[model samples]
Target: MSTKALDAQPKFAQIKQYIIDNIRAGTWHENQRVPSENELAEQFNVSRMTARRALSELTDTGILTRSQGLGTFVASFKSQSSLLEIKNIADEVRLRNGHYSCTVLSLESMAAVAPIAIALGVEVDSQVYRSVLIHNENDTPLQVEERFVNPTLAGDYLQQDFADFTPHEYLSHVAPLTEARHTVEAIMPSNEVCQWLGLFNEEPCLQVIRRTWSAEGIVSFARLISPGSKYRLGGHLTFKKKQP
Candidate 1:
């Protein structure tokens, strides 16, 4: 597009694009305040109303947050997770504009036991990376993820800092997931499960056993447990006929 064509666009639209570009470039990060409308107006050589229009539009779209006494800051990201597919807890929390956090209870290289080896479709005593993770949304504990990973899928599993990234996120980047299966059910909490999720002995827990696959073979098997009283399983799907 020519400079004249660009200049001909609506001032608010241009300002919005400029702000978006800065955000995409990491010049502005989450919770970081952007320039005030007065500052933006002066910088863009536009009226305050035009500048506010850009900020207002972004705020409405869940990009920016506005406060009465304090200045506007970038809104936290939050979204719903996919129940039918492998979803990263961090990504799901952020999409819903909620804070996502994790505690890595354990990350170790261990020999897969009989059940774990069967789940991964590998020989008994095969090497695997195992981790225990507690995922939280907005500071409240939600789920405990006990996962056994095929080392071939995520060779660097023990090195990465899970506090900054989730195993699901890491696996997606390293090993492409071709498919996944999830089975959810409610069960009486075990001693370990009760402690990890802060559930009482009598309380039942919602458990989701997920098996993910890659082109090579089974990628990882995860047992996700959460307090039944606190969370209910959810899913999103579209109804359609099978293609011929």
Candidate 2:
């Protein structure tokens, strides 16, 4: 096999790009084992850690798979998810060639409760907006989104038609993103959430809670419940050096 000459880029980044390019070029077929870390280090004249970093990054990016005793192999590019990136459910379903639809359950203005106040970094009883929507894909219920918006930041949210547009698309254009926190868990859906999602009483669901901040402060908080059968979560992870 012909190997490309390494450039002056960072060791890990160069390694990652090399693997990606090779995979894209079909030099390394899916599920096919690549060179060993020591062999790669020798070829690149870099340390083992650098080679490991490259392989780890590819593994995290779903380009490679590391088996316990079978060694590292190229990963299959099937149903790969952009979990690391914040995605709109409607858009994701469309990408999968599935029909997508949503029903708005509630959209109103209210006062932030204690937990909400703490989440939004606002005073108790501050004005907030709440919305609940159930999303379906190909006629199968998928996700139920229960969202709270800090009206002080996200203005006139209740007036918008969410059925035509997603909150993520709207807020991304309106608010400058600053930070985000995501919490994921598996649980049984509540009676109301289950009814909205068309899930049986014993069916399990995936709960995802996301809080987003803008330049003004916490702008939105959403609790999403997804039917386990219809939804699966996937993402990539990377490690970076600390800045001084």
Candidate 3:
């Protein structure tokens, strides 16, 4: 957005950006302590609630982790990415002994773009449902999910509360997957992704795009992004000696 747009932005949002800028600037490295709610309120001359909202939003997006006794600290990404063939991110967090939470940014219908159309086997410009979600582990932002659904396959998608359940969990319960294709790459996050993930523009993100099919046909297409500084793809395998 333009400078005027940012200037006109809300104070909490400005605080959010300020926190991200410091993180990116190495002023607040991983595991470092961030200003307390009272301190931030004083520094920004805003109410404690305003400061808390800024910090809460950042924590929800996985930039900071809060403890019951300890003050908030820059979250460290020490856990591995999903190892299951069909990775449910919530499950991943649980397996790592972390509390899981989600914030649903959007769930709406729009005309499909070309790539999304092909992924859903719908014609370009066909109506499709899309949702943007942020998943956090222990109040730290973990992943940003951008999902496009075939409306015919998931007609009630918009009616569901994703914050109570994940798009992956809901779809898997509604339409069991028959096939899936995944693509993974590391790249600089987009402007919006950077904002949502609480990362600087130069921060790298692990991008995982996937398309799924149910017995009835295409079910959904999704893009999942993880902060590269804190996430990695991981799996385990067993080896056998042949007639040793």
Candidate 4:
């Protein structure tokens, strides 16, 4: 927008729109660093704080990402999940034409704690299979999957290569899902979570507490974490028409 036009309305909003317009027009591609606050302020004849607000809002909404000492850049394409169904993470990334990979951090049998036992419908201190993994999209960390499995249902849980096939894929093969439940929350990331996801301290995360059931009983309890700027959950529905 021209200086005169920008002056006609809220300058900060106009600056935000200007950046968004450039991005939409492909003038600024993904991972391409945009102008600094000082540059933007100089261009728009506004204070740095006004320019900073424009950048900050876009960053919070996932349109842009700011790296410490590295200026702002357009955000990478976000990974998305279904709110209506259980879907595999690998498939979700590939559906967006992005490469998918995973790192299996830990896989072992552990005694269930009370909360885990309650979630998994198991007795406290019972042996359960636990796996911790980081799912990546295009080599960038996307989701942290920490799961506790009912050993009776998936007997060979620890033997498989999770880097080759996800826990969701393997569990589905062993004990097909009869039902699933999910609870989502936005939370501040722990230091460990931040390190795993390569997230800054200010970035919030989306946490999903999930439980899956098979014909016999509860199969697993899982905690899924994703950086708010890197992942989203959504669903679409169509309503039937009523008789007029």
Candidate 5:
């Protein structure tokens, strides 16, 4: 490694930018282990804490990853997708000429809250299925879907292979649909959600609140939020023609 003069920024910030620049320049490849904090400090003529801050910030930003008893390594870069449809995120990615994948963050059975129950037309405190899914386009985080399903209609949803099949596909096969509603807005992502989406501080997100109903009642409710730079929602409606 060359010992270039560090920039005038804070030692940590300077070190952070150095690492990022090297990574961008391809000096550090994906999954490649970076130098230890002590080594970096020696190379940069800084304290170990300063070097550690650089690595820590990168890790927090998902540019690098650290493992206990192991070492820090470069994180893989990701790409985003733009698809406007009420469909499976994985399918959307695939259709957009990108690779599609998902990570199931959590799957559990929980009691529905009053608002959720009312939306699903189920009794308050009824058992409901909840799932948190992180969908990626071309290995880049695109959206985080927090979904709730009426277990009375779609039972054992937690057992399905979401990576291979979408909730929309499974629901369409099982549930009888009647109506659908959607509301879109903008919001800042939470820390956890931001990590899930691999978003930077400047990136805003488009938040979509959706509800689907069946003959029996409301069947599902979901909150889907995507990085604004990566997604946009669009639709078209036509009015009925009156007989002359």
Candidate 6:
């Protein structure tokens, strides 16, 4: 860590970045315990509170995990998605050398409720397609996908065999998303969702509420949920410096 660089940011943020950089550089690895607050406070010449804040923030962001008696360790992100792009979950898992599979729990057309209608930009009680699926990585359920589709966008949604292709892949072929919006939050999933994802009691889930549009109209609205400890969202962006 550079002294000038350390001076350039808040003490806690600098320390946090130092830890992140180390993790990125492979100095610290998954399941490896990180330095304690006392050790980091001494190294950074900051209070234990500052060091603790750095660790807490990282842990909250899913970069680290903490145990009661054990120290903080790098979190093993078994499944990851890019915050910058829309991708197929099956492909995402396979890219990481994990086996991908899915079970279609429900696939049917139904009358849209108020929230589903609004999300799909359809009239209340209008016909829409809904599909519920559990996506797995290495036979462990990693995500629970609940999606409502605009019939105008993907009329054949309920007819396809999801075993042959994911809903994302099917929709992309028919509609080809021109725009998308996503909202992410940490949530305590519903009992059914927890059961599908095989999460323990009180375990937090990362939820992404997503809406996508084609050149025609809103294509689909989806809620994708995963156990926070097993999945993570990340992105990398590079900005070019402006000319003087």
Best by lDDT: 4
What is the TM-score of candidate 1?
0.64
Comparing 2 and 6 by lDDT, which wins? 6
lDDT of 3 by residue, 50-169 (tens): 999988977755667788789999877555654447777887776444689998899899999998899899999999999999999888888999999998888899999987889988
> How well does each candidate superpose onto the true structure, as a TM-score?
0.64, 0.65, 0.66, 0.70, 0.62, 0.70
Which stretches of model 6 miss by more than 4 angstroms?
Answer: 1-75
What are the per-residue Cα lDDT tens digits for candidate 1 across 1-244?
A: 4568768889898887777767767999988999999999998899999999999978755677889878889766432344766667776666544588998899998998999999999889988999999998878778899999999878899999999999888898898899899898888888977787776557877888999998988999999987776665445578999999
lDDT of each: 0.82, 0.80, 0.85, 0.90, 0.79, 0.89
TM-score of 2: 0.65
Error of 1 at 132 (Å): 0.2
User: Tens digits of per-residue lDDT for model 2 on 1-244?
Assistant: 2334556567777777777778768899979998888988998889999999888877764567899888899876542435477888787766544578888889998888999888878889988889998877777777888999888777879999988888888888789778888888899877987789876656788888899988888888899887776666786577898999
Q: What is the C-alpha RMSD of each candidate to the true structure, in Å?
A: 10.2, 9.0, 13.4, 12.5, 16.6, 11.4
Off by over 4 Å in 1: 1-81, 240-244
Query: Residue by residue across 150-244, what tens digits does model 5's lDDT show?
Result: 99789879889898877878887888667788888899889988888887685778998889888877789999988887776543466899999
Model 3 poorest 10 in a row by lDDT? 75-84
Candidate 6 residue-wise lDDT, 1-244, digit = tens: 6878778999999888888888878999989999999999999999999999999988755677889898999878656688899978887766444579999999999999999999999999999999999999889999999999999889888889997789999999999999999999999888999889887776889999999999999999999999988887887698999999
**What stretches of model 2 exceed 4 Å from their correct place?**
1-82, 238-244
Top candidate by TM-score = 6
What is candidate 4's lDDT per residue for 16-125, written digit by digit as tens?
88887788779999999999999999999999999999899787555778999999999776766778989899987764445899999999999999999999999999
Which 10-residue span in candidate 6 carries the lowest summed lDDT?
90-99
